[model samples]
Target: MADPHERNGENERKPDSTDDANLSARLKSLDARISQASAQRAEAEPRPRSKTDSSAIGQAFRYSAEFVSGVIAGGIVGWLVDRLFGISPWGLIICLILGFCAGMLNLLRASGTIKPARYDDKK
Candidate 1:
């Protein structure tokens, strides 16, 4: 029968120089890949901006325009309803609610809060 020690000795033996060289090359490649991935992640992440920055002003202007447009449209609809129904202020109240909804919609659109529909050719 073969000696158990001989079998164990092979398992316990250290790898040769070629194995070490292969391991070193692999580790170097992994390190390079990790560094490249880290750089890519850093580039993809959003950087912080100051509150008083020009972009902030532009965003505020966009929101304000949306809100104002909503309010104006709501007021007009309310006036028209009031005139049609012969109601003095009921239409105004309804218009106010609609205006508020429009403003919220506009805000969502401007802020990219709402996702736009995507068309696929397969459909």
Candidate 2:
């Protein structure tokens, strides 16, 4: 059986500092090449996003949820008011219109179409 610890006569030479220095130079050269290729790739123009890349479907769901939540909240309030005041259809109708407006406003706010209010100091 061959001994694992046995070194061949040619391989028994002492480790040389020149070999270590050469190895370090080679490693630095490889690192520089890798960094150059990486920078070039980063500078390259990106391809247009497909559906999976952009995920517009998730955004659509979020917008729809925001709008629907607003409407549902308004509707609930309107229903409560109708039950409280004995106003049958008029209250419900007015509340529904208000809810739709609220939902549209919510959607606009969410989409950045509506500007947010900024408070300034009165000094």
Candidate 3:
């Protein structure tokens, strides 16, 4: 009778030093390939600036500019309406309130607290 541990006149093969060396070499080659590919991809595609890329002072200035522009534009429109309609106080007051609201909205949008509203005209 044949020995139970033997098959085809050879013992069930155990991995030898050569197998370990070959496996280590293959693994090193794979690592080198992965690193090369990663470096190439990084060079080809630069990362975009993240939301926090803006400095605190730059963000503050941007927010203030958005708010102030809305207010100034509203004030100008209101002044024009008041001048044309002869409704002095009422026109100025109503427009000032609207301007303040617009400025606040602009500020919120600029600060990323709110999404900008978009109007689409479907013809």
lDDT of all the models against the reference? 0.84, 0.80, 0.86
The list of candidate 1 runs beyond 4 A from truth reads 1-54, 117-123
- Assess the local accuracy of residue 69 in candidate 2 as a C-alpha lDDT between 0 and 100: 87
TM-score per candidate, in order?
A: 0.52, 0.51, 0.53
Task: Please write out the lDDT profile of model 3 over residues 12-91, one tens digit for every residue.
Answer: 98889999999999999999999999999999997855676468788888888888888888888889999999988887
Give Cα distance to truth, residue 120, candidate 3, Å: 11
Local accuracy of candidate 1 as per-residue lDDT tens digits, 26-65: 9999999999999999999999754443586787887899
In model 3, the Cα lDDT at residue 105 comes to: 97
Among all windows of 10 consecutive residues in model 3, the one with the lowest summed lDDT is 114-123
Instruction: Point out the worst 10-residue segment of candidate 1 by lDDT.
Output: 114-123
How should the candidates be ordered by lDDT, best one leading? Answer: 3, 1, 2
Q: Residue-pair clashes per candidate, as listed?
A: 0, 0, 0
Better-scoring candidate (TM-score), 2 or 3: 3
Best-matching candidate per lDDT? 3
